[model samples]
Target: MGRMKPQTLLLQSKKKKGPTRIISVTTIVFGSLILLLFVLSLFTTYRYWSQRSRNLSGNNDLEDFDEDGEKFDRPVYAILDTSKGSIVVELFKEASPEIMDKFFHLCKTGYFKGMLFHRVVKNFMAQAGNSQRVEAAEDWMLDMKPQNELMSTKHEAFMLGTSKDIHANKGFDLFITTAPIPDLNDKLVVFGQVIKGEDVVQEIEEVDTDKLYRPKSPIGIVNISLRRQR
Candidate 1:
């Protein structure tokens, strides 16, 4: 057989390599498509579960004003456990009696445990309270009727306050404002303060939040036990 020309050899090499290149490119493209689909599915799953969880517990009413309303006189300390660190909250009962009473009862009855720190407004506040238990949700929503009463106070650095809403969910989830969102003065309730863990409160506030005020990180209430401070 005549020796193959250099051009012929080169042409034969190109033909052999062409199919390999096509196969490699096809593999890469297919892998990327699969990865993209997996990511989308994961995101969709996460969103569905999150919304379902919020809506299911959203109907809970945490406040029910009785015929004879109760008020707390002494200061109370709440021990909070977040995924980041421990937070010791000091409630000013004198400043906001009803608000503290409501918060106290919620803590005493184990209502705030297992709930997530759902909202975190940077340099403003961190909000939590929504449980996995069906009973907790039922208790929360039992007294959700609208109350015209607006509990307002000075937005002091350590003060704790409930948000205003037609129902209880907004107030049930409490937060501490970092910057004086002065506009919020009339809208939110100032109930307590961070006598000890201002730094921890600020830490929580730094958590990433979504438009709905929900945190991107899954921070939860490890515990919510309170004690009457001297």
Candidate 2:
């Protein structure tokens, strides 16, 4: 007993740490690393979204018809054939020439013939495009690294959504404004209006939607072609 007492005192004097202390220290270090990673991730996301928002105004119209013939300037036209019905959309070259050019090419090639409107928000709008195209656009956006600048256009009725608006994202999909949401004015680009078959849009909206607002049934565009409504 005397010898054991001496040994215990010696061990105490050495200040040996227990398993719990060692585990606690390791956990603290790991927690600090995790916190640092989270902060970095948040900062990166903010910077990405911020860059996308620069030069971003909601008033731009992606396409529309010039009611008055006085303005001869017009953008290229592309007609779309949907399961609901046919729709005609007029383009706007004055607002965005580059985007219009790309759109025209995509249409002429029939790239969006069978694409689906993968996403639809009831009160907001419908979004469609080529899934592969969207991914490619996002990659290009990250590669180019756009600067901050406000678009000098107005958002009308069915203006198209560009990769820039959603952050260097593009696809064959598009969306139509359900009703006049005052808050979206001059913020989202309005490219065109529903020339015909707006009822289809209504029917799509009426269907039961999910949390993301996507409809239970698929809304597919059977075919798309260009036409002059002279």
Candidate 3:
């Protein structure tokens, strides 16, 4: 204890010498470097999240994913084939071109095959995502980041909604509303609507859940098939 104090006092003192002064200078330099690094890291973190917020949740969506803007004006459809039955969804590509494009591609590649309808709330929504599959997904699947942005759309019954992280980044996680969700209108992007098989959505929501809202028997996606109506 006696020795430790003297060393701390020495560090605080302004006295100079050969080795002692050199050690003191070195300590000061190291401390200054640490502070600089901390400040830089804070700035960098802020910038990275700021840019992501703008890109992912801001007013804009990634440009018409198609090179020639082809998919933007079309009527894109996604059929979620489940154990209960098929739910046909009419995706609003014109409103969410980028999100629809990625959804279409993911459906085409069977990315959501056998994924559970993990969360179901009666008269609310049926939520699903191949989250565990994404963790072990190949490079190509990982590269197809599910980009999203909020639109002027509202959450009505049968509307498809995209999921967002705390950072407001979008992912393949998705939900379909079986009833109007007034509170979620500003939080999640409404990407599509169930045009057929509303009964299937209701049946899926009838699934029993534990405290975690997960279905007891594990209802799941057989696969999602995509098509466009011209």
Candidate 4:
């Protein structure tokens, strides 16, 4: 072939460049689509796992509520038949299990039968459960010693009282609050609350008291009956 003309050479170059450019553009578009698809797939997977985790957490919460409901349904209650009147208390097992267990055991064994409300403070609390005064008692007082283990609790109105001394002696002394006693929270373990007949507690607090804050006459605990209900 003779020396090619400039136009011919230019036309050949154009023809070669057209297919090269098309191939480059097609490769870039295909690569971009692949990257976009990968990103979308990653996002979808992340969302699925996140939703699944939340669902599992929700289920766990429901299960916890169910367990709590079962315990709450069959709570242990104490009925105090006293001279003033009857007062019903709902013992919290979860808050102070050890103390409540001891209390229930005492009630079951007639340990609180004929016990006196030894210490009574107006607008504060009424303390009792001292088996020391029982006529037929023999080493029963020693058995009533409180286990002063500190448990988490709040000092609210109508709550029962426990103290370090009471725990030390393992004494079975329990007190019912007539008012809120937040000041005693750190020093006292409140294991139960008056659920019914709070007015009876107030009436007892207003009864006759001498210098020692003890009832002048006799504010006796006739008996303590334990009732389990659902």
lDDT of 1 by residue, 1-230 (tens): 89999999999889887454345888989999999999999999999998776554322222232213455444556677667777777655454555656666676566777778765656555666542222432233343333344433464455666755515554386666665444455556666666676787777777776765566778887777665542
Off by over 4 Å in 2: 1-76, 130-159, 163-167, 170-172, 183-187
| Candidate 3: tens digits of C-alpha lDDT, residues 119-228 | 77676677787434232213222343222433234646888867544124444877787766555554456778898998999899888877656678979889877655
Give the lDDT of residue 19 in candidate 1: 52
* Residue 184 lDDT in candidate 1: 52
For model 1, name the residue pairs that clash. Answer: 60-140, 60-141, 61-140, 61-141, 124-178, 158-193, 160-191, 160-192
Runs with alpha carbons beyond 4 Å of true place in candidate 3? 1-71, 130-153, 166-170
Candidate 2 per-residue C-alpha lDDT over 1-230 given as tens digits, one digit per residue, 9 for 90 to 100? 34568878888967875555345888989999999999999999999877665423111232242333323264445566787776666654454544555555566556777777766656556667644443432233244322233323343344444434533454434666555434343344454556565677766656676755555787778865654451
Q: Judge candidate 3 at residue 171 and give its lDDT.
A: 47
Q: After superposition, how far is residue 160 of candidate 4 from its true place, in Å?
A: 1.8
Q: Residues 24-139, candidate 4, lDDT per residue (tens digit)?
A: 88898999999999999999999999888756543222222222223343566678888888888876756555566566556656788888887676766777866353321122
Which pairs clash inside model 4? 144-172, 145-170, 145-171, 146-170, 146-171
Instruction: Please give the CA lDDT of all the candidate structures.
Output: 0.61, 0.55, 0.67, 0.67
Candidate order, TM-score descending: 3, 4, 1, 2
> Order of candidates by lDDT, top first?
3, 4, 1, 2
